[model samples]
Target: MLTILVTGATGNVGQEVIRLLLNQNCQVRAAVRNPDTATEILSVHPTAGFSDHSIDRVPFNFTNPATFATAFQGVDKLFLVRPPNLANVRKQIAPALEAAKRAGVKQVVFLSILGADRNPILPHSKIESYINRLGIPATFLRASFFMQNLNTTHKEEIKTRGELVLPAGHGRTSFIDVRDIAAVAVRTLMEDGHSHKAYTLTGGEALTYYEVADIFTAVLGKPIHYTNLSVWNFIKQMRDRGLPMDFITVMVGIYTTARLGLASHVTPDVEQLLARPPLTVRQYVEDYRQFWL
Candidate 1:
């Protein structure tokens, strides 16, 4: 049986990846910051039909190189994800990759951002370039804005306040689903034909802020509005909301660059990999309706 190490195993994509691999009866080592939180986290996923499989919730901290010594032992594959703190990536991912390579891990599937090559100063790009240099079997899965992102803070705010605010002027996004991202990652890690492959994972269709608002209205059965503010205005709004300056800068850069025709490109890669159609926005809205209210 192939053993896989899953970094960030409790996050959105990581959680989905873990569930899928477990369904396939793969030996999974969940590298978490805390083992005690693992059971509670899986319980919340509500994997009603999922069969129990072997899961080792090991304490692994990316910034701590010593933790990787034990975490990478006997691992064949890794689902690599940089934590939410963009600033700490160098202190984390750089060392983890080295440990995986040293452990003789066969394959590595990385979750990176779209257009990572364009902005060298961007943390996502920096990580992408770093991973690209490693002389190992690597797959970089570059993804655009996720619809699931909205399903979090964006959805709550919209449901509570009836407003969608952002600095994406006239920029449209074909937001990929986290489920699709997970599918690509799992397929890359477990199957053949994906080594050294770079994929731009995207949504089935591109939709602007106005179009997204229409979809929201149809699903929630309530009026919703999309406001496209200037980049400066968006930055100001986020700052006022108490977001960190570094993250706000990154978000604004992504938003403005996206407006210039970066993430608007649609790709059929998800369908190609999954052997079926990717989920549509309306379907996502319907499936997650309970959260919208």
Candidate 2:
């Protein structure tokens, strides 16, 4: 029974990872900020389909060095994800990696963004460098933009304002589903021949925000529009919504990168990993149609 410690266990990706791992009867320790709340949430998660006893919950905080040792104990592999709110990798993630190293953790499968190595401006690029500096047996899952963002970050506006507003001007993105990314993470954690490898995960196709809006309209049977705003207006809207400046900056940067056509690259990695076609944007929109409605 190889034990894998999962950071950010309650997040979108982590929860899916834990669910998929448990379906395979793999031992998973969910490292969360609050074990009790996490346990409750997992038990009730619509897709989790597991009880509290199905997975282990341990207190782990990226900012707290003390919890890392305890969470990493007896863990053979680690599933690492940087919390979206935290930008300072040196102060937040470095300590945890040190603790994992000290705990003698064997391998790390990190969730990194696409083009992290080339984009030094992104924090994930710095974290990737740090992982390399540690010389740990690591695999980087460089995933494209998540399709779940439709259900999360942009959900409210879609539901209330009937529009998708962003700075991505006619830019297409390879929107991969988080579930597919989780499946790849589980395979890398459990299988062999993946160490020291970097896998770029993306959907089968690239679609622009306008195309996504059309999908939403088709699926929800209503008129949904894509409001392409200027980068300045996007920043102002996010700030007015009380989002942190760092998060807003990162969001805008990624959108700008997409607008420049850097994010439109589609890959076969997801299909190659799963031996099946990746989910399409239309399918994703149809699956979550109720949310948009």
Q: Estimate each model's TM-score.
A: 0.93, 0.97
| Model 1 per-residue lDDT tens digits across residues 1-293 | 88999988888788888888886657888899888787678657733322334578888997778788888999988888887664555675788888888889988888888877676776767777777787778888988887877877476678887778877767778788888899889988888889888898988898888888899998899988888888888888888888888777767777786677676989988998899988888888887777878
Residue by residue across 96-171, what tens digits does model 2's lDDT show? 9988988888999999999997988788989899999998899999999999888988889999899999999988
What TM value does model 1 have? 0.93
Candidate 2: TM-score?
0.97
Q: Which predicted model would earn the best TM-score?
A: 2
Q: Model 1, residue 244: displacement in angstroms? A: 2.3
- Name the regions of candidate 2 deviating beyond 4 angstroms: none
Name the best candidate (by lDDT).
2
lDDT values, one for every candidate: 0.81, 0.89
